[model samples]
Target: MTVLVVTNDFPPRQGGIENFVRSLCDELPEVVVYTSREPRDAAYDATLPFPVVRDRTSMLLPTARITKRAVQLLQEHGADRVLFGAAAPLGLMGPALRRAGARRIVGLTHGHETWWAGVPGTRQALRKIAEAADTLTTVSSWCEDQIRPALSPAAAQRVRRLTPGVNTRRFAPNCGGEQVRKGLGLEGVPVVACVSRLIRRKGQDTLIKAWPLVQESVPDAKLLLVGGGPDRQYLEELAVRTGVSQDVVFTGPVPWAEIPPYVDAAEVFAVPCRTRRFGLEPEALGIATLEASAAGKPVVVGDSGGAPDTVRHGETGYLVDPYNPVAVGVRIADLLSNPQHCKELGAAGRQWVTEEWSWTRSGAVLRELLDV
Candidate 1:
């Protein structure tokens, strides 16, 4: 059961989908990948076990050359399953893959397909692809709900939920964050860490706004803002205006290999993501929250997107208003104050992730989906 994968999101980029696609490929034996990035240029290419075909086109979208080559690969390998790593890519090469003897045509619908569907042209094309594909899977319930209306009744029936998974062995309760703390100069302090790209939708500003209130409750507590984005300068300015500059530490864009230590550095992990529709940028199956939980840390997230699926409200972590700095502050303060409760919640999260959300489990589901 050879499988051919078409995807724009691949290594040399850092993201949830990129990691998920790679993990899925790692699970299957007969899989080949095609990507927009060239193999010679990417640093992570050598790390992958499967073969990959690189496109030479300058166009952002899939080109005719890619389509022809994909069909060639499918027919040549006798590949029965052709999995489009994303919904958008299917619009380009789906017809060719079907004609080339692909028994299973599958597309993965992440959160942003909902944003693309808002456009009249893209919406119709997405629907056509949905109707054509054998199945379409979503990483989050929010994404599944967002895409359902755009799909035909028959295509909608094929929709399935497959949330992103965490590598529990790599990210666990006993993993030490001494390096993360030493690098960020947050030694011997109660840290509230937020690990995500510092963007408007991720609600880093809301967390910064809530820092002063958090300070009054736990004065020595530090807000460790990890990851890089356009919001860095603005967030720094806001911290200055709010006069919590010394307390907020920014480690811009840590590498994927180093993410676990950052998670381990925190007593509480927070991702106060807000609902953004213009780009449809919801949390959509938060791998970070799961990673934090795996590392035995209590999580604090907003009510939007797939966050609720990861954090079990009061059981694992608190769900607060992403826009409300006061609420964010209060939750952090509560977690910081109660060491025993924090340990309890963190243990609960670790146990849950260990039992339920592992790459091994996700791989089994993906194999079942491809019927391989």
Candidate 2:
């Protein structure tokens, strides 16, 4: 079975969706990626186990131009099935694929892309793509629910929920705590790490607001903010105003391969995601939480979206209200004070991820849907 995966997001441009798509390509057979990014070097082609075709068109081009290039690729590759990794490219390519001789088309949804409540023409375009596709797959049940209302009865029946997977082997708890702590200048401090883009919806502001309260109890506690985005300056100001700027360290946009080491260096991980103007907390599945859990680190995630599904409250981690910074602070302090409980939670989390969220298991589920 020859499959052609279309996506704007790909490796070297790091994010959950990009990682998920790359991992799927690694496991699947006779796969070719049609991406917007041009290869930077010969290593880009040599690194990939499978063939990758780059469409060297400016992203600012009109929809018709994008559609023409995608259809041209489908014909050139003689692709049996067309799998879309995002809505924009998929919506643009849907009509073109119908015009072509392609019989099977699959569309994938993740978070905010499907949460079109009041947008003009966005819902209609999404519905059209859903109706045109033979199957629709989403990363979480939350996303599936968001898109279901936009689909026809037959289109709705084709929707399937397939959660993203983590590479457990790479993210395991192998790094020595003392060595990592010393290297980060956190030798005597309890580390509270957050690995995500510093955006409003990610709730970095909430986490910064909660840090002072956490510091009052565990005075030696340090907060590490990983990843970067447009909200960096605003979040930095929030940390200063909240009187916790000295203890906070902002490692702006670390490479994807380097993130696992940072995850292993921390004592606790927090993701206080909240709803934004776009929609209700656009998190389909918390892949970072799973990676942290696999490293045997206890997590504290927001109650909104798919976070509650990833975190098991007292068992794996704590689930607090995203709106309440005090509640989030209290949970972090409680876990730090009770080392025995923290260890137990971490152990349970690691076991849960290994059993449920590995890439091998996820690939099997995805392949079954592709029926390859």
Candidate 3:
């Protein structure tokens, strides 16, 4: 089976969707990738195993010109299937791609589609593309719920679950994590690390608010904030204002390969992503949460969207309300205070991820659903 993946999001770009596309392409067979022309991607493209087609389009999504080029690539490569990375690129030319005579036209939806579906006219746009698609895949059951209702009963049947997974090979437990602790100048005190884009929706502010209470329990503890974004200055100031500035450490965007150690550095990993705290879409799925699970670290996620999916609540980790910092603080303290319980939860999580969510398993599921 020959499969062609078309998307604006790829390796050089950073996001959940970009990472998803890269992971899927790595597992799927006889796949050719199509991405927008970015000068930086020129070097990155060479590292990929599949043949990549770079379209010379100025915009991120080649909506206006994708039709002609897609048909041409389909014929040249003898491919009978096309997979769109996300809904926007698929919506732009979905109808045209449908009439182009491909055996299957698949649309993949992430959590953001729910936010877009809530907008005035986007529901109909999503309905159109999904109806035209032969099969539609969602990153999580939460996202599947978002897109399924928009289409007709028959069209909705096309919606299938192809959940996100972690690369256990790169993010497994026991890969030498001593480097992370030494770099932070921390010696054997409990640490809670949150790794993500420092956006309001991620609930960094809420964590900051709860730090004082956390300190009251474990005064020697440290909170490490990894990854950089626009909210850094505000969060830094808020940390100072909250009187926990000295206890908090913000390491601006660490290298991708170096992330596992950061996960290993802490006993508990927190990502309090929410729906209403910052009035944004809740996290679709916490890939970092899964990464933490792989690294044998218990996670703390918000009770919103797919955040709960990552942590099994009382098993792998705790699911606290992102708006309630007290809950977050308490969970962090519980994990840190009892080292044996923390280790048990982390071990259970590591075993769960290894057995259930792997790229090879998810790819095979997608392959079967698409009949490719």
Candidate 4:
């Protein structure tokens, strides 16, 4: 089937949704992508297997023009199915695409996109998308629950849960832990790595606050923060004020290719995500935590959102309160202090991801949905 995925974010641009869409393309055949971002050079466009239709419109164009361009692209592609990456803006184009020869419409909801209950127009737009689409799929069961209340009776019945899959081949256990550790200057010190955007919602500050407690017990433990964002300076200051500056190392925005190695190097991976009303905390699945687990590293994630669905509490790793730094620190220290327990937890995590979260498996599920 020819599927046209509409998304605001894509590879060359980084985020969970971007990664999810890119991985989805890797699994399916005859897939075409329409994105808002344009490449600097034309040559880069040829690199992807599918045709990348770019929409470059200035801010001057009203919402109607943008919707028209999206509809035009859907009509031009002759897509059998149109998948909106999120409910908002992209899903707003759903009715237009359906009018333009697309047979089946699917809106992919990711956490907060569907959690806009109080917003007047936003809720109405989401309801429109849900009502218009043949199917509504979310990345996690958590998201399914969030959107269910707002969905029309018929739309709620069609809503399905399709968790994001991890590329096990790219993020496997054999990435060499010692080599990655040495490369990141974390040879002797026990490393606790957090791989996410340095943002408030990600709970990096919460992790930084927890570091002092972890330090009291494991003074030599190092915190490696991967990825960068607007909250870089603020997080750095938080680390300093918390008196864990020397223990914290911020490796700003590492390439996607290098992220796996960093995950492999860590003794434990932390994702202390907080809730956002418009944005779902923990989204559907915590891809980074899954990736870290797949790399044979135990994960320490927050209790909110869809994290508990993956973390498995004591089995795979610990789930802590994102707002509480002391609990976060204590959990990190527990994993760090016991190497045998860490290995056991890491093994369990790797097993869970490999068995349940493979891209090949996700492709089969997606194909089944499209076939129906």
Candidate 5:
């Protein structure tokens, strides 16, 4: 029943997919992780309950050497099942691992694979991986639709939904946000927080564009941009150019452990994520939005890809056009302006997430797929 997790997306490489894989692994009985080498990974691995074997390379491709090593690990760990954190290129090794010893193989798909399905070159490779694995799990229905077309008829039939689950206790209302609010000098200020990496597709620029309108409604409102990426400098410059630099607070990058407080401190959580690269890039499932909903914050999500699946529209939050700053701004302003409505939406969001998106439920689905 021991499972071997093969992925390049594990922590100390912080991302939505990394956390999703780690959380699912926590639900397994016995496991061993085989992932790429990352800075500070040794310390992170030491804290984990399972054994984590690191590949010398930082990024793992489906090469002969890597596949050979993966097979060795499969045999050494006596792992009967294999889970690829990201199915795409890594899942290409599934046939090899199965020949080596793995009885069951599961490959999880995130955003990129959805795009891979549409491209002619990558679509063939994606189809091969899909056919080889016992199951290919998708984070949302939109993703399943996008990927299934690239898969063979039989492989498409094996596709299953295994969405990421939120740790409700960790991301609940009143999770001690007072310190964060005081530290950020945001005490009593209406704050709209976007907890995600700075990137074009993530729509931080759109948020900056929308900020002026938000400020018009709630004069003292602040825009909190959390996490860092290549787009930080561009977003900061854009914020300045848009004349809202004074009102926007960029925390650069915050550790995952400290994200709950930042999320709790916000009056409204938003990530105006959009599809990019002419529909090749999408928001996948938007785990941050789910986490915000879990924290009892009404989210203003961008209507892109599977991100819409995270919100219940009028009930939990509002979905806006990611490209339309006016739409995004108006929804955010309305939420901040009406505290009672905000509270109601937040409470309902929290209740819905607690009941439907628990990690225990996600784990049970994984266990069933693994047949363990």
Candidate 6:
């Protein structure tokens, strides 16, 4: 049975969820993708192996029209199995698709559904989606804990864990970092890199706030802020305000394929993510941090939600209180100051990731869940 992948989060729009969904697609036996429109999507889709159906709308809501389109795709592709990339609202269309002859429906939840599990109205909506889907996949155990309780006992039992995988070969040590450093004129500088959307919850501001302390310990250290988001202006202004503007390099919106070189360009990687919205929005599982670890760089991740699940503190990396800039700075500085310690931690991370977190392992679990 061909799997029909449905989601709003897909390339050529760049983000964690987009990359997660796209990577999972390669694992499926036969698949057809139905996602919202993106600029340069035609060029992107043309490069893909399977068919990609773009919606007129840029974002899809589970309205009657959206449901109709999804059902039509299922029938056209003869896809008995349907996979909703980020679950929640998209998974709401499962019932409609089932009525149209879909056998199995899997809804993958990142961190957002954990929040959906809390609020009253959205919690009901989440439960409904959970009931509709044959299996609900959570990216982390913490995420599974947050979302499962909100479902009915039967639906809760169907919840499973299927985290994203890292391509170890693609993100390895010396994978074009020297060239990236040369291009940026950052050759031989001790760099702390954060690769994610420059959003408040992802904590670029906290990284900036912590920069002065990092600089005190390693005065020649530079901050490499990658990816673009709404918070770009705010983060830039905050960097200037913190007096780390000259040392901070913003590589706005790097291509997905080019991310590895940038990841390799850092001495240490950090993302001080925090829970916001009264503990609603949290970092689900930081793919970037895992990528950095895969690149043989020690990571400093935030102690937010599922983020801590990504790092083995002091062994692979350090987990700091996201709200505490001093704590974040200290960890980054410690790694920067001690080259041997950093190398040891990074080597441990690389070994751990190679043994555990590979696309083959993730794909096998997903295949079992989909049973396709």
- Counted clashes in each candidate structure: 0, 0, 0, 2, 0, 0
> For every model shown, what is its TM-score relative to the native structure?
0.95, 0.93, 0.94, 0.94, 0.99, 0.98
> Which parts of model 1 are misplaced by more than 4 Å?
38-40, 57-60, 277-279
Can you list the residue pairs that collide in candidate 6? Answer: none
Using lDDT as the measure, what is the rank order of every candidate, best first?
5, 6, 1, 3, 4, 2
Residue-by-residue lDDT tens digits, candidate 3, 1-372: 788787877777666677888888877778888777875887888887789998777344544567778777877898877888886545556667666657777778877687666666777777777777787787777777776777788888877888777888888776656788888887687899898889988888989998998888899989999998899999999999999999999999775667888888888899888886343476788788899999999898888887777878899988998889998888888788898998999999999999998987888877886577
- Give lDDT for model 5: 0.93
Task: Encode model 4's per-residue lDDT on 1-372: one tens digit a residue.
Answer: 688877766777778877887877777777788776545524556788889877774121217877777677666776778777776657767777778877887777776665563367777778887887888887776777777888789998998877788877777776876887877788988999999988888888988899889988898999999999999999999888889899899989987867888887788899888776545344456789899888888899987777778788899998888889989999999889999999999899888999998887877877766663
All candidates' lDDT scores?
0.84, 0.79, 0.81, 0.79, 0.93, 0.93
Please identify model 6 stretches exceeding 4 Å from their true place: none
For residues 1-372, could you state the per-residue lDDT of candidate 2 as single tens digits? Answer: 777788876775678888888888876787888776544624566788777777675242227766777777778887767778775436557767767756677777777556652255877777777777877787776777778888788988988877778878888896555665677788777898999988877788888899888988899899988899999999889889988889888889988887887888788999988766646456677899989998999999987666677888889998888889999999999988888888899999999999988888878877777677
The 10 consecutive residues of candidate 6 with the worst lDDT sum are 352-361
Q: What would the per-residue lDDT of candidate 6 be over residues 270-343, giving only the tens digit for each residue?
A: 99999998898888999899999999999999999999888999899999998999989988998899999999
Candidate 4 has a TM-score of 0.94
RMSD list, candidates in order: 1.8, 2.1, 1.9, 2.2, 0.8, 1.0
Candidate ranking under TM-score, highest first, comes to: 5, 6, 1, 3, 4, 2
Top candidate on TM-score is 5
What local lDDT does model 6 show for residue 82?
Answer: 93
